[model samples]
Target chain A: MTSEIIIQAIVTGLMMGLIYALIAAGLSLIFGLMEIVNFAHGEHLMLSMFSSFWLWSLFGLDPLFSIPITILLLAFCGIITHYFLIRYILKAKMLIQICATFGLSIFIRSIAQLLWTPDFRNVDKPLLEGRIEIGSVFIGQPQLYASLVCLVAFFGLYWFVTKTETGLALQATAQDRHAAEILGIPSNKMFAIGWAIGLGCVGVAGGMMANYFFIFTDVGINFALFAFVAVALGGFGSIIGCLYAGIIIGLVESLGGLLIDPSFKLLYVFAIYLLVVIYKPQGLFGRY
Target chain B: MDSRLEFAKSEPIWNTNNRVFSIIAGLIILLFALPLFGMNSFYLHLFIMIFMHAVMAQSWNVIAGFSGQISLGHGAFFGIGAYATSFFYMEYGITPWISIFFGMFVSAIFAVLIGIPMLRLSGHYFAIATLLIGISFQVVFQRWDLVGAASGLWVTMTPEDSWFALQFHSSKVPYYYVFLVFFLITFFLVWLLSRSKLGYRLRAVRDDPQAALSLCINVSNYKIIAYVISAMIMAPMGSLFAQYILIIDPDRVFNIEISIIVLLITVLGGIGNVWGPIIGASILVPISEYSRIYLGGTGGAVDLIFYGLILMIICIFRPNGLISFIPKDILERKKQR
Candidate 1:
């Protein structure tokens, strides 16, 4: 491959990594706190894409402008979903959590098919339509904005998680929910909040994706797998880990796929996953 | 509390009164008599599909229902068996029946490669990893030069040689009998698993890995074993499917739709029950098939929606499954009374 192609691949990978990071950030928080795998998390993202699509169609709203609404709406949805099904598995086995989440995926996908049907929907006007020319290397306009938004979101989340009171409480609860409860941290409610935030990120991602691509029911499964692999690679519950892992995955997907076919990229990722589990296990940034 | 505990601990006492058994027996008898009644080829074809799906569901139940490891990529092994046999038949001129062992072996190898690290993930990641494995394989099969990529490979062997070829042109009877044997074998395996030490170990690990580990259960090894063995069972079914359909495609075999269908079956009949998948497939497939036939081209998402609603209801109220309702009181008696 040419140096230009390599550079472009890295740039594009980094940007895509950011998008994965945004989704993975909230996902990590929920897993860290509640240990409930949001099987419908990707569906939430899928729905958010639909929301953004319709919002743009009806009201001419920019995806950037619709972010807050999507986040809030998804937050509410997450809380409700948790209350209804996930919380029951909060104290249950990992298998229960799996079945429940699998069911959740089913429910959400079905509902999505019902309301929107299976037709692929997208926004026509590109959020990042133009591009930047850097000598022979060119960057898509959307790619630049997506990376920027991702970086900003990550930094903001890191700051808020470490610096703020509730953030600390969230962390403490994740570490030891019973102790947090004994210390009067309101673990249950905080977990509900974490779920909301986790879902909010999925929604945000959905909207962001809508700007660059189309929406469908099955769309969530691919991203959800990315998030799961990212969370696992980054270690179970660490925010910083998810961010880094997402970026690593994004780059590898680009560079590795370029070397081989894109079809073989997952084989590489799964290999990485196995290596990480056997070696680091705690993840590169996993909490001790 | 004892009764509630019993309910939680024991299988629901089989209620002989439930017409579910009679209905099942009646259906089987009807099917058995259908060939004797001079049935047309269309009905025979439908029966073959039901049997194949039932066999699929039963294979899935071993891993998902019993082991509590929700592997969404059961289709991977199924595909492997299909492709392996097809490749062997075309290239080496091996009998598909003999080649099935090779298919199952290769598929099991892939399962092990997947099962080791992935089995550690347990719930969401386990399912996601399995799904990714299927996706990866789908991508591999679609693009790999050897398998003919997305267009897929077709067996060059004609089905006309003899009865020994395991290929038939005029009748669905062979297909139906093959799937019937598949169903019985899978059912027996799951039944045996339910009563065996392996089953106990799997359930223990599933219930609490740390505790299971504390009890000296090698959690990862046991889970990996369950997953790989389950894959071995699926391979032949895949081989059979490819032979019957005479087509092998990545999307057709390794699709997410297969994952959902298996999940829906286990969920509907109630997870962890022996007959759950059989019951679920029987109930859901006809509705799904009819909807597809009736809806024809336009809007066939109704089946998905139906499953979604059923899953939600199942998950929320009857978390144990549909089987729990009929068997609850009996189990309660075993535990509490």
Candidate 2:
């Protein structure tokens, strides 16, 4: 590939990495605090896509403007699932929680499929049509916008965790739930917040991702696998680690296609994951 | 060994409930014979699929159910077994009878490599790690290029030989008998395992690895052994399944759907119980197959919804499986009488 092609590839990959890191960070936070893997995580993203897609198609609202609506809607659904279902199995074995969420995921995916057939849907908004050229490399308006949105959302999260009392409670729960509870942090409410943030991250990511890939019931799986690998590589439940791992994963997917088939990207990701777990069972930045 | 046998005899063969099992067993035999009367290929295919799936779920129950170490990569082993036999037969004209056993051997070795390091992890680590491996195999198989790459590998071997080819064309009856043989073998294997010292150790490890280790059990060894045995059992079943379908594809064989269905069945049927997956496969597979007829094309997700609901209910009410829902005290009373 030429220098221009390489630069463009890197830029595109970096943008993709930021989005993946955000999605994975959401999943990591939920698992970090609540110890639930959220098998329906991808489905939540799918839900947000359907919500945004429908709103835009039906009401002609701008997709970006529907971001808040998607976040609010998915957060409400996430809270309900956590309270009615995941709350009871919080302290149980992983298999049970996995099945519960796994089932929940399929259930929701089925509903999405029922409503939105596996057809590609797109929004041709004027705001998303332009591009910015830096030197010889080019970046599309949507990619740049999505990347900016991801960075903004991430910083907002970082600020909330450090400055806000509730955000502190969420972090504390992840550190030590029992200790947080003893400190009068109301661990349950914090978990609910964690769930909301976890899901809201997915909502925002989905809204942006729909700009790149078409919407479908199973569309979430493509990103979900990447996020799962990123979390495992970055160290489970570590946002910083997810950021590092997500970019690495993105670069691999783009560059690996040059060395081997693009399909091997997943295989390479897992192989690296196995090596990490074997060599550093606690993960790259894992506290556990 | 003698002392262990005496200890086993003192505890009792089964934990009560003779009447119910006998009735259930009788019903199963009748159900197995149901296709004999109908001669309907559709129902026969469905029954055969149920048997193959039951065999797989039962094998998974050995590790996940008895030892509580769930591997999402079991689908990879299933794919390996099927592809190994089909490829060997197609490439070198090797008889399937021999290739099938080799397939199990290959799967067992694979289980050992992955399971040795993985089985030590507790809870979600183990599950997530296994999922990564499953994805790994899928991507690797697709890229190998020797196996037709992403388009998927297919064996055009004719279904001519009855015994050697493991293929039949006359009617679904022969295939039904073949699957029955496969299912019966799996059932016996599980039965023998659950009654043996190895089985007890697996249960102990699953219940609490720490406690099992404290008791001087080689927890890691036993866990790996359980995985190998489970993988071995599943491998041949995959070979049989591949032959039955007369086509072998990575996506079809190694689909995450296989793992999901097996896990759902084990969870639904009452894992660790010998007949749980059979009960699960019998109930769920046919329904899923039938639903696909009505639910396919337009983003059909009905089967997924159904399977997910069953899994959730099981997790909430009876984590030990449906068998746990049975009143233990009543069974104990029946045993006393």
Candidate 3:
């Protein structure tokens, strides 16, 4: 491959990675705090994407304009899901927790199929519709804006978790719920907050993705699998790790597709994941 | 006094075993007699599905339930079985009866390959790795032209019924009996395994791998054994299903939904128990089938919605599973008395 082509692939991979990071950040946070791997994390992203798609299709509202609404709506969804489903199973066995989330994923996907007719929907006439050329490389405007927004959101999340008192409490809760409770942190509330923030990141990804990607009930699953990989690769529960890991996955996917066959791209991604898991089970950036 | 106490303990165990054996024997005889009464083909088909899934779930139970290794990618083994059997039949015109064994062998080998490295990871990591492996198989199979790629492969069925071919013409009866026998054998094998030393080792590893390791138990070896056994058991179902359906597709057999459904059925019934998969399959298959027939095409996923709700509820209320519920309650009542 030419240097220019390689550079383009890298750029594209980086952009895709940002979106993956955004999606995985929530999953990482939730796992860190609750030790529950929400198998339905991708379904929530699917829900958000549909929300964005519906808003666009129904009211002629641009997905760019629907970002805030989608985040708020998904945050509400996260809260409700936690309150109704997750809360009861908080102290359940690992198998039970996995099943509950998995069932919820199936439930959400099936419901979406029922309600939305399983037809693939995409936002027509998105605001960012063109590509921008820089020297020898060209980039889609949607991709650029999506990555920029993701970068902002990721950094914003980092600021919230590390700098603020609420963030410190959230971390403390994740570190030791009992100790945090003793120290005046409402661990339950922190869990709720974690859910909201985690889902809120997926919401952001969904809204941005709604501009370029096809929307369907099962669409989130395709991306969600990658998010899981990113979370695992970055070492679970580290936001910065997810960001870098997502980028690495995206780059690998794009470059692997370019270098090898596109169909074999996932093979390369999985290869990296297995190597990391075998050698570094804690992930590239995980403290554990 | 010690001998008398041992005899007292052994007596109840023997009695309970005899009672369970008799009940199982009675049920088997009833199952064998059902077709003679001229049951409808639809119910027979449902029974076949229940049996097939029960076998598959039991296979899952060997690893996830007994060995405490949660594999989210068992569909890969199922797919391997289906594909291997169908390929042999299609390319070489091998009968599915013999080809099913080939499928089982292939799946067992695949399980070993996967289990060796993956068994090292604990908890959710193993689950995720298996899930990825399942998806990767799907992707590869979908793209590989040798296996019919995305469109899928169809087995040609002769008009003449051939027992050797494992094909029956115009009747679900033979298929039902074949599946019933297979289900019984699988269940019996699992029961025997559970009662054996290996089963105890598996249970010990599951309960506490550290303790098991300290006691000199080869935890990895036992886990791999469970995984291989589970995969081998699951493969034949896929082969039978392919022959029964007369078609095999990567997406159909290799789908993650299949894996999830197997897990749900096993867990829903009572993981690790011989009866768990049977009970779970009996409840789930009929409900899903009925929902599909009644509530399908209504632009709403009523069946899946209900299915999801039931799964959530079951996980919450009876996490040990539906099969364990009545017995536990009965035992409690007896204790109170």
Candidate 4:
């Protein structure tokens, strides 16, 4: 492949990687707060995309303009999910916990299919329509904006987790729930906030992605799988690690596709995940 | 022991009671007699599917339930069995009776290769690894041209009803009986395993790996054995399903939905017991079959929505599963000494 093509692939990979990082951040935030991995996280992304699509299609609101709305909407979804489902299974067995969220995922997907009819819907003629050309390389405006927005949101999440008192309390609860409780950090409230912020991150990524990607009931599965890899690769509970792992995965995906069969791109990504997980079960930056 | 303590034991005591045994024997006889009463093909097909899924779920229980390794990639093994059997029979003109063994053997080998490396990871990590591995198998099979690529392979129909060929186009009755027998054998073997020393060691590994290690149990080795046995049981069901359908496809056989449904059935009935899958399949299969038949089209997803709700509710409220609802008298005939 030409050097120009290689540079182009790198740019595209970086963009996709930003989005993957944002999604995995949400997952990692939740996992860090409690050891539960939200299997419904992909469905949460799907819901955000659908929410964005509806805003654009029905109200003529552009996806870019609806980013905040999607964030708030998904945050509300996170709260509802926490109160309605997560709270009940908080102390359940690992298998039960996994199944509960998995069931919720199936339920959400089924409901989406029933309502949306399973046809692929696109926000046609969105505000971000054209591509930007820089010398010999080209980047789609949607992808570039989506990635930039994801990067900004990811940074914001990092700031919130590190700088804010609420974020510190959330982290404190994650470190040791009983200890945090003894120190006056309401574990339950922190958990609820964690879910909200976690899903809000998904909201930004999903809203931006709806402009470029197809909106469908099943679109979240592959992205969710990738996010899982990113989380595992980065080490669970580490936000910055998600960013690094996401970029690496994106680079591997695009480069693998460029060098080998495109159909086997996921194979290489999964292979890397298996190798990393087998060798370093604690991940790149995991504490445990 | 107090009555509460007696009931607290995870293992049901009804197995040793001749009364419960007679009841179970009577139920089996009734099930066998149903086909003779001229049941329609649709219902016969439904029953066969339930039995097939029961066998699959029971096998899954061996690994996930007793051993506590939740593998979400069981479709890989199921697909391997189907693909291997179909490929051998279709290409070499080998009878499915023989090819079925080949499928089981291949599945066992793949299980060992996968389980040895992946099984060491615990909790969500293992589950995700297996899930990705399963998806990878689907991707490979879809691209591989030797197995007809994405379009899939068709098992040729026999000219007549032939036990040797494992085809019975004339009647669904034979297939039903065949599946029923397979289900019985799988159930009996799992039951026997539950009582064996290996089963105790496997349970120890599941309950606490560290404790198992402290007791000198080869935890990983026991897990691998359970996983391989589960794969062996799951493989033949795939072959039987292929021969019955006379068609095999990567999407149908290797779909994650197959693995999920297997898990749902096992969890719904009971996770850790031999009877769990049988009970789960009996309830879940009928609901799914009836919904697909009646609702039709995308409306069939209605049952799946209900399935999701039921799974969630069960996990939250009755994680012990519906087996816990079995009458106390039927469950325990004698208190522990």
Candidate 2 docking quality: incorrect, acceptable, medium or high: medium
Candidate number 3, chain A TM-score: 0.98
Q: Considering TM-score, where higher is better, how would the candidates rank from best to worst?
A: 4, 3, 2, 1
The candidate with the higher TM-score, 3 or 4, is: 4
Using lDDT as the measure, the top candidate is: 4
Q: Report clash pairs, candidate 4.
A: none
In terms of docking quality, model 4 is: medium
Candidate 2's error at B237, in angstroms? 2.0
Please report how far candidate 4 places residue B259 from its true position, in Å: 1.1
**Residue-level lDDT for A220 in candidate 2:** 84
| Clashes (N, CA, C under 3 Å) per candidate | 4, 0, 1, 0
Query: Please, what are the lDDT tens digits per residue for candidate 3 over residues B1-337?
Result: 2343344344443344445567767999999999999999999999999999999999999999999888888899889888887888889988888889999998888888877877876778878888888899999999999989998898778778878667887899999999999999998889768756688789888888999999798998899999999999999999998888878888899998789889889988998777789889999999988887887768776777776777888888888898776666432212221
Give the Å error, residue B323, model 3. Answer: 1.9
**Candidate 2 wrong stretches, greater than 4 Å:** A1-4, B1-6, B9-39, B150-154, B157-161, B293-299, B329-337
DockQ per model, Cα: 0.45, 0.59, 0.67, 0.69
Model 4 stretches with alpha carbons more than 4 Å out? B1-15, B327-329
lDDT of 1 by residue, B1-337 (tens): 2343344345543533345557756866776667777778776766677776776777777777667788877778888888988888878888888888998899889888877777775455577678778778888888877887898887785747344456777777777777776777677677667656677778777667798898888988988888877888788888888888878888898876777787777777767777777778777888778787886566546677677767766666666667676766442223233
Per-prediction TM-score: 0.89, 0.92, 0.95, 0.96
Which candidate wins on TM-score? 4
Candidate 4 lDDT by residue in tens digits, A1-288: 799999998998999999999999999999999988888889999999999999998899999999999999999999999999889999988888988998999899988888788888899999898999998999999999999989999999999999999888898999999999999998989999999999999999999999989999999988889999999999988888999999999999998888788999889999889888879988898877
Where's the lowest-lDDT run of ten residues in candidate 4 chain A? A111-120
Model 3 global lDDT (CA atoms, 0 to 1): 0.87
TM-score of 1: 0.89
